[model samples]
Target chain A: MSKNSSNPFTVPEGFFEEARSRAVAGASEVRRRRRNAGIALISGAAALAIVVAAGTMMRSRTAARLYDESAGWLASAEYDVFLANELIYENGMDY
Target chain B: MDRVDQRFEKIVQEYSEPLYWHIRRLVVSHEDAQDLLQDTLVTVYRKLWQLRDPSKEKAWLFRCATNVVNHFFRRKKRELGDRTLDEYLEQTLRDSEYVNYTEAAGVKLQKGLLTLTPQQRTVFTLRYYDELDYGEIARITGSKPETLKVSYHNAKEKLKKIIEEDE
Candidate 1:
C-alpha cells in the first residue's frame, strides 16, 4: 500500500471533515430533490385523474343530450329542431 | 435518528476519506474530486434502499465512486475531445488554489499515468497504489478479471517506458 508521504500525491488537511460536510449536504439535497419529484408525480396523477373523470362526465352528458336530440328529431321529422336539440345550452334556453 | 439516516451517516464517516483519495487520483483535481465525491455520496444515499446485500457496502461504495469519476470524465471528454489527463494536471498546477503535490517526481509519475487510457490508469492505480487484488478491482470496475489483468500489465509496461523516458 502507498504510504501517506511516499505516494505520488496527498490531500489537503481536514479533507475528511470537509468530505463529511459535503456528503451531509449532498444527502440532504438528494432527499429534497426526491421529495420534489414525488410531489410532482402525485400532482400529475391527480391532475390526470381529474381530467379523466371530467372527460367521462362530459362524454356521458353529451351522449344523453345527443340521444335526446336525435330522438326528438326522429319523432318530429324536423331537421333544424332536431339538430338544435343537440346544442348544449349554457346561458339561453331557446332550444 | 432514523435507522437509514444512522446507516448513511456511518457510511459517510467511514468511506469518505478513502473514496476521496480514489476519486482524486481518477479525476486529477482536488476540487473536482470533492464535488464528485459529494455527488457520489448523494447517489449512494438515493440508492441505499436498493442495496439488498449490505455486506458489500465497501465494494458498492467504491463502485459508485468509480462510476461518478467515469461520468465526470465522460462529460469532460464530450466537452474537450482528445484532451489528456496530463493537460488537466498541468492546468491545475498552473492555476489551482490548492494542488499541493507539485513536485517534479510526483508530476512525472502523474504524467506517466496519463500515458495510459483512463480505464488503464484507474485499474493500474487501484492495483499499484491501492494494492487491491484483480478480483476486487474487477468487482469495483464492473470489468472481467482477465481484462483488468491485461489492462494492469499494459499500464505497468507503459508506465515503465514513460518513467524511463522522463529519466
Candidate 2:
C-alpha cells in the first residue's frame, strides 16, 4: 500500500470555465464532422450504385446488338453454299 | 442548474486545477496543457453518456486526461519541439537553488520525474500529482493494474533516488 502524496499539484483558478467552453465547442465540431461523413458515405454509395447499374445496362444492350448483327450476317448467301454443299453430299452424289 | 449540469460543473470546477496541473506537468507548458485540457474535457463530454455511474466520473476524466497528455507528447515528438516544462524545470534547477522551499521541493521532484520515460511519466503524474488509485490509472492508461503499479513504483524509486542524490 502506498500513501497519497501530501502536496498534490494545484491548478490555477478559473480554468474550468475556459476548458468547459472549449470542450463544448469541440464536441459540436466532432458531431458535425460525423454527420458530414455519414452523408458523404451515403451519397458515395448511391453514386456508385447508379454508375454500376448504368454500366450493366449498357453492357447488356451492346451484347444483344452484337448478337443480332452476327445473326443477320450468318443468314445471308455467304452461308448458303456451305449448307448446299452439305446437302449435295448427304443425298448420295447428287449434283 | 440541473442535476447533471450542476454535477458536471462542480466536477469541472473542482478537478480542473489538478487535471490542468497534471497536464502542465506532463506537457510542460501552460499553453499546451490548456489545449490538451480542452481536448480532454471535450472527450469526457461526449462520453459522459457512457458513464452510468456518476461517482466514477472523476476517475474516468483523469484517465481521459492521461491519454490526452500521452497523445500530445507523441505528437510533439513527431513535430520536434523544445523540451516540455518538466525538462525546462529540470535544466533550470540543475543550475540554481529554487527561490523558496516549496519551489525547491517541486524542482527536486520535477527533476526526478524528468528522468522517466514518457509512459512512466504519465503513470507517475497520474498517481502522484493526480492522486489517482492504481485501478483508476490503469483504466486511464489502458494498462493492467499490476503493470501500472510496477511503472509507478519504478518511477517513484527513481524520483526518490534523484532527490536524495541532491542532498
Candidate 3:
C-alpha cells in the first residue's frame, strides 16, 4: 500500500468545489437535452403510427367496396340466366 | 434549498482536490489537469442521474474522470501521431522548481508512470496516487479486481525499476 502522500499528485483546495459546480450545471444541461429528444421521438412515433393505421383502414374499405360490387354483378347474372330458361321452356311447349 | 446546488457543494468539498490530484498526475500539466478536472465535474453532473446508489458516487465520479483523461489522450493522439508518452511529457515538463508537494509529485510520478503500459499506469495511478481501493479502481477503469491486482503488481515492479534507475 503506497502511502497517500508518498504518491505524487496534489491539487489546491477549493478546486474540487469549482469543478463540482460546473459538473452540476453540465448535468442539468444534459438532462434537458435528453428530455427534449425524448419528447420529439415520442411525437414522431405517434404521428407515424397514426398514418400507418389510417392507410390500413383506407385499404380495407376499398377492398370491401370492390367485393360488394362483384357480388352485385354476380346476382344480376344469375337472374338473367333464370329468365332465359323460363322463356325457352315456354317456347318448347308452344312448338 | 436547491438539492442540486447543495449536492454539488458537498461533492466539491469532498472530492475535487483528490480528483484534481489524480488527473494532474496522469496528464502532467497543471493547466491541462485543471481543464480536465472541470470537464470531469461536468460529466459527473450530467451522468449523476444514472447513478442509482448514492454510495457509489465516489466511484462513479472517478470513472467519469478517467474517461475525461482518456478523451484527452485520444485528442492528443489525433493531433500528434507517433509521439511517445515520455517524449510528450519531457517536452511538456516545466524547468522551474515545483512549489508544492502536488506539483513535485506531478513530475516525478509522470516520469515513473511512463515505465508502465497504459493499463498498468492507469491501474497504478488509481490505486496508489488516488488511493482508491481495488474494487473502486475496478469500477473506475472497468478492469476486474483480480486483473487490477496483477496490473498493480506489475506497475509497482516497473515503477521500482524506473525510480531506482533514476537514483
The predictions' CA RMSDs to the true structure, in order, are 7.7, 5.8, 5.6
Q: In lDDT terms, which candidate is top?
A: 1
Once superposed on the true structure, which residue ranges of model 2 sit more than 4 Å away at CA? A1-14, A85-95, B1-18, B42-58, B77-86, B89-112, B115-121, B142-167
lDDT by residue (B1-167, candidate 2, tens digit) is 44545555566667767777777777655567788888787777667768887777878888778878777767766665666645554544454321233555665576667789877998888877677898877777888999998998898888888877888
Question: Tens-digit lDDT track for model 1 on A1-95?
Answer: 12343345556788789889878877888778988999999999999999999999999999999999888777885876655665635445564
Chain B TM-scores of the candidates: 0.86, 0.80, 0.87
* Superior candidate under lDDT, 2 versus 3: 3
Q: What ranges in model 3 sit over 4 Å off?
A: A1-18, A75-95, B1-13, B42-53, B95-106, B142-167
Ten-residue stretch with the least lDDT total in model 1 chain B: B93-102
Residue pairs in collision within model 3: A16-B16, A23-B41, A23-B42, A27-B45, A27-B46
Model 3 per-residue lDDT tens digits across residues B1-167: 36665676577778887888778767777778889988887766665558888888888888888899999988987777788756775565543223244544445656677757778978887877677899998898888999999999989888777766765
C-alpha lDDT (0 to 100) for residue B96 of candidate 1 = 55
Distance (Å) between predicted and true CA of B15, model 3? 2.6
- List lDDT for all candidates, in order: 0.79, 0.72, 0.75
TM-score of each: 0.76, 0.65, 0.67
Decide which is better by DockQ, 1 or 2: 1
Deviation in Å, model 2, residue A33 alpha carbon:
1.3
Model 2: how far is A86 from its true place, Å? 7.5
